[model samples]
Target: MQIVIAEDSVLLRAGLTGLLADAGHDVVAAVGDADALIEVVERHRPDLCVTDVRMPPTHTDDGLRAARQIRERWPEVGILVLSQYVEERYATELLATDTTGLGYLLKDRIADVADFVAAVDRVGSGGTALDPEVVSQLLARSRRRDPLERLSPREREVLGLMAEGRTNTAIARQLVVSDGAVEKHISNIFTKLDLPPTDGDHRRVLAVLRWLEGLEP
Candidate 1:
């Protein structure tokens, strides 16, 4: 896939570009700031934009803000944001709207070349790729006596993995359960959460959003 990278650090940006290129992806442009990111994206219109959360002109959330703009203007292009830590607020805001072709991962995850490349591939293909830490933080901070109380412990586990954008087969492998058993648990989760069935993957995304919503006050 053709890609663009937005990162302030020269080394990290170059590293990301080289890594993706080595993985058989085309790196069309790599820039240092949010403004440049937007310009290049507009010009090149790459398949994906992998960016850092904080970038130049403010050194705050410029990259993230620019990412939002990219989504608004060219929703077809995929967005994969990399952050230094698990910022739940940023995670929530980023995931609040349409999740297709969206991803939020920690910068540390880049160390795992295989997993990072896989995440890029997923998001580039119009799939979600939220970090496990993001899901875990939300799960930990969830208030008591919420709708999620309806879920069993195992069901909750399934839900969390779902939020991390894991497929049924991956979830089964992680939990050491049969794919059939994973399907059963997922069905039970949807029923318990009051989510009507639609397309299977769409329902999974909804179930995850529902779980995230329940974490709210």
Candidate 2:
């Protein structure tokens, strides 16, 4: 697979470039900043993009912003983000789309080269991957909805996907349920959250986003 890398750290950038090239994958561009990253990506449109969460010129989430831009213009290109911290906000934003070709992993995991490469391959092949640490922290810090505490395990599964911007049809596909069943669960979710019934999709999404934001550290 052809890949483009965006990492401000010279050592890590060199290592990643060497490893991918040695594995017989084309390393089309290895850039050091998010602007350069975007320029190369827009120019080459490689098979996948691997970037650090923090990158140069301000060094504060430039890569994440670039990733969001890519989701807008080249939604099909796979994205894998490496981060030093387990920011649920970052993971949440990264996986906002229903598409599976997105991944977020902690940077320390790069030491396990084989596993890191496998994750890259997974994202490239259209699969979602999140660091186990990210999953645990996200679930732990979210609002303690005691009413959600009353949900059946299946209902809780549905709620998580809803928080991830999934449609009822997509949720049904994920849970292998009928659309009717998914709608029933969504109604239950609204009632439990005390959200008034709404006709627009944006209202429900806003409610969920606010709920998620309130749980942030």
Candidate 3:
């Protein structure tokens, strides 16, 4: 596989080049800044681009932003971002747009050279290779913003029962609550979930569907 590396650190950049070269992959170009990285990518159009999140000219997220632009313009070129830390905002944005031919691994997590090389190979071949920490962070962020998190414990139980095809009377019986109380809880659930009142049955079904969606892996 042909690869391009963009890292601000000279030693790390050379290390990456040597590793990829030793792994039987061609290092078409190794640049030290985001702008140079972009230029080299356009020139070589390598199969994969290995880049650091922070790079020259502000050193904030120039490399990550450039990676996004590269993915937008040349989607066929896979991107593998190596970061000192997880910049969740840009990382999530990149993955949210498209995950194919993409990878995000922390620098500290690359303890094994073979694993790092395998990740590069996998991502270069249009496969995903997210670091475990990255995956965990993404999942945590998703859960934090989950709509179901707004529901109270009782409301969540009511929703689960509703998803199980339980009527208000049955739900009340299961929860040891009066039918009127169950009705109020159901109304609150609908309101909190923002389920419109198009039709009573349709709204109930929609609420149940929302609950079911939250249960997805």
Candidate 2 lDDT, tens digit per residue, 1-217? 9899999999999999999888778999999999998899999998899999899888988999998898789888899999999877777777767657899999998888889889989998889878999888877756554455556677777878888889989999999999999988877777766677566665567557655764577
The numbered model that scores best in TM-score is 3
Ranking by TM-score: 3, 2, 1
**What tens-digit string does per-residue lDDT give for candidate 1 at 1-217?**
9999999999999999999999999999999999999999999998999999889999988998999999999999999999999877777788887999999999999999999999999999999999999888867756434667899999999999999999999999999999999999999998887787665557777889988997788
Give the clashing residue pairs of candidate 3, or none.
Answer: none
- The CA root-mean-square deviation of candidate 1, after full C-alpha superposition on the true structure, stands at 14.8
lDDT of 1: 0.92
Model 3 is weakest, by summed lDDT over 10 consecutive residues, at: 194-203
C-alpha RMSD in Å of predicted model 3 compared with the true structure: 10.4
lDDT of 3 by residue, 42-68 (tens): 999999999999998999999999999
Compute the lDDT of residue 89 as modeled in candidate 3.
Answer: 91
